[model samples]
Target chain A: MQLLRSYQLLVTWQALRKKAYLPLMMAVQTLFSLGIVLGYPLLFPTLDRTTIYLIATGAPAISMITVGLVALPQTVGEQKTEGSLAYMRSLPVPRLSYLVADLTVWLGIVIPGVVLGVLVGAWRFGLDLQVSPLVVPAMLMVALTATCVGYALASTLPYMLTVIITQAIVVFVFMFSPLTFLPSKLPAWLETIHSILPIQAMGEVTRGTIAPNEFGLPPGAFLVLAVWCVLGFGVTYAAMTRRG
Target chain B: MLLQIEELTKVYRTGTRANDRISLAVGEGEVFGLLGHNGAGKTTLVNQVVGLLRPTSGTIRIDGRDMIADPGLARRLCSFQAQAQVPIDGLTPRQAIDLLGQLRGSSKLEVRRRRERLVDALDLGEWLDIDAARLSGGVKRLVAFAMAAVSPGRVVMLDEPTNDVDPVRRRLLWRQVRTLADHGAAVLLVTHNVIEAERSVDRLAILDQGRVIAEGTSAELKGRLGAALRLELVLSSDSADAPISPFPGSSVSVGNRLMVGIPMDGAGQAVTWAESLQRAGAIEEFTLGPATLEDVYVALVGGVETGPAELEEARSATAA
Candidate 1:
């Protein structure tokens, strides 16, 4: 509960939203739903709409991962710049508890971005996200895993350079990850690499839930995701707790 | 003891000792001044007292609770208003005060009743809805102090409380501080502003390089330096130079206004000198006065002296 309403996180969220990052991403999401979603079926009348629906439902997996990798670092970097990090430590709460609140707030924000992406995919592509309700928890697990991975990278990098590296990684992983197209479309070696990447797990999980037959992810994606979550948590927690 | 420090020592990582075996105690109803130069461990001492930093080897107790063993309990008894503004940029002034009070365990009714007076006194009606980042520097400072005083912890440690405040409001702030102390809160003020120190603090501890060089009333500290007399002189007019030569060794000029200094006295000579200056018309409008905190501050630390007049000069210089 303390982690939910921390002063720094609230202020940081306001600052981030005002930066036009969230609004701009949201705008793109709305367009994706309205244009490619409805316009695609209208433009290609001969194309089968079920597969198109499947593609639309899963297409945003890559974009969500891209935004997550790039935008999440701004959260931690803003805290450092605002001087509230030191002030927060000055309070009576245990250092770890305060940091946990920061992590929780950033993780919370990712939910909206991911959900918006998925919702637009559903509404525009004309395919129902036909996964079991159980997939909601499974999808959350993938988001949590991606969150930790992004947090680790952000915390370890310097504030000025955080944006650059995060943007680069977002682009790098979005290009190669197997969630967008079929895994068999990739060369066999690249297919192995995609299984372990943070974004790849989310992509695979979303595609598997939405269209399990054509875009089946390997069973080991979950194992790779768990490993990423644990390692990311360890690295980021160490970075936040290091002595000022 | 409202506050206690025993052999408080804070040594920086590079081996320079910021605080060196300092110890002091302030009972309730006391406004204690911690005076020091920029690197004189004033803030380091304040930080430990407020639990922002731990003593390298010493212990701090607030309201008799060991600060380290149960820090949350200790925090209940004390609040720290730091020199740097604690940035609560998105919060409006009214919300900021209420939030601070709530965080410190004040009841909703208590916060509701207390916040109105604070809002009015701080003249924050205009800023009550504006976020802190949008307010001016002085306004943010007022908010910080108001937040520290919302519940009036048993001990409130203020580091340079008057920074970014105008002179008219500084007096108002000191009055508020006195009211808090009179109500039984132990107030610790850390500052380099000797004028503010002279006029406000009931007791002062001059800290030199992390050690208490002297601790007493302003009069006691000045009296120790040597024989001193309070010299007072009225201005001939708003603009005439009030002869200040007769009062030797110290002077403070508030404006084209009164000048006074308690000169060092060895067997009452400072008095005789004041009379002599009176006779010579150097101080045509003259009376002997008491020594001040500025005098004590200069004697303890080697530097060019500052009185209200010099401060006036410095202010004009910056303006020019």
Candidate 2:
């Protein structure tokens, strides 16, 4: 009963706290997603059907991933620097309730962007999307893993370092990861690194679900994402629950 | 005692001792003040009580339950206003207060009533709907106080509650603090403001260098200065550096101001000496009043260096 009440309170508290900037945040996310979908094609004179499918499906994945990895961390870092995080910790609410509430809010913020990205991608490319039944669960798992990791980073590191690390992550995700492209195009060493990291798994699961006919589902991707999701929650829980 | 602390000690990993073997208790209907200068361990002690920080070695009891063993219970029993103002950039005073009250498990109607009372009491009506980011620091502080006081538990711990507040609102805030205690809550107030604490707290402990140097009712502490009167002189520019201890008392000098302790029997002589100094253009003005808790504080905090020999010499000189 206490857990349920705390969860309800935290959701309302977090939603109100974000009410002012949520619209602006969503607009930015939409723009970023639209930019990838609309602008990336301008870089190429002619795109093949396979290329179109990859870019169209990859836009939504990037949008969801960015919300969790980039936007969530920045917000948490600001809260940490402002001492609001410590203030919240001092409350009598259950720690897990706070974490779940935060994840729920960030998920809400990203959903519109993810949907818009997928819609705009299909319309722009005039491509066929074989959306699988697993799409919703796959998107949720990717977002949960990324956001929990971001939360853990912000909770454990100093604010300035978290900011810097998040920025570095943005560059790595956009430039190095195979989210928007084929893994075979990258060097073997880079692919090997991506195999161990969660970013590739996030993109692979997302791509498999959104374009199942074009890409096969890899059993290892789900296992990798689940491992990261649990690890992130564990680290974040430890950080929040530790005394002094 | 509603809130009891025994030998509470907190030492940071950096090896700095923030609190040292401090022990104190507050009864259910008491407004107890923890008075000290900056870095004197007052806020540190409050943080431990509220479970934001852990004490290295100590026992905290709220209503006979060991709080250190169960910090969740500590948090449930103690509602705290942190030293830093809560970040509510996008929130209004009303929303912030109401949300916190609900978060603390108050009913919606109860939250509304408490919010209205706090807004009226703090004179926050004009700024109730304004964005807190646009409000002044004092208003934000008032909002933070309201948030904590809205659904106060068995104990309410406030740290530097009056720091940036205006004089009028400070009095109102004090009234609310007392009201909290009157409703059967133990109030633990931490601050560096001596005069306000003396006026507001039923009992207080003065901390220095992480240790409690003195503790008692305001009158009891002031009585330590035993019939000593405080003679304050506004020295003229020309006499700013003059060593003007014509009477028997310990004196502390700060730029253009001098405070001297005089025996009550020497009140007339002290006044006459002040008049003489004024006539000679050594001082611009002077006032003589009974020593206050501030005097006892300064003496004990080593501001006047009241050593045994100096105290004996002052006594003999006053007698002669």
Top candidate, metric lDDT: 2
Q: What's candidate 2's DockQ score? A: 0.31
Predicted candidate 2 versus true structure: per-residue lDDT over A1-244, tens digit per residue: 8888889878877777787878887788778778888887887799887778878878888888788888888888877666677788888777788888878988888777777888888888887787999999888898889888988888777777788888999889877888888888899999899999899998899889988999988999999999999999899898777776
Interface RMSD of each: 9.4, 13.6
Which numbered prediction scores highest in TM-score against the true structure? 2
**Model 2, position A102: C-alpha lDDT score:** 77
Candidate 1 CAPRI-style tier: incorrect
Cα lDDT of model 2 by residue, B132-176, tens digit: 879998989999999999999899999899989999999999999
Per-model C-alpha lDDT, please? 0.66, 0.84
The parts of candidate 2 lying over 4 Å away from their true place are A42-45, B246-248, B302-320
Model 2, position B193: C-alpha lDDT score: 84
Error of 1 at B254 (Å): 16
- What total of clashing residue pairs does each candidate reach? 11, 0
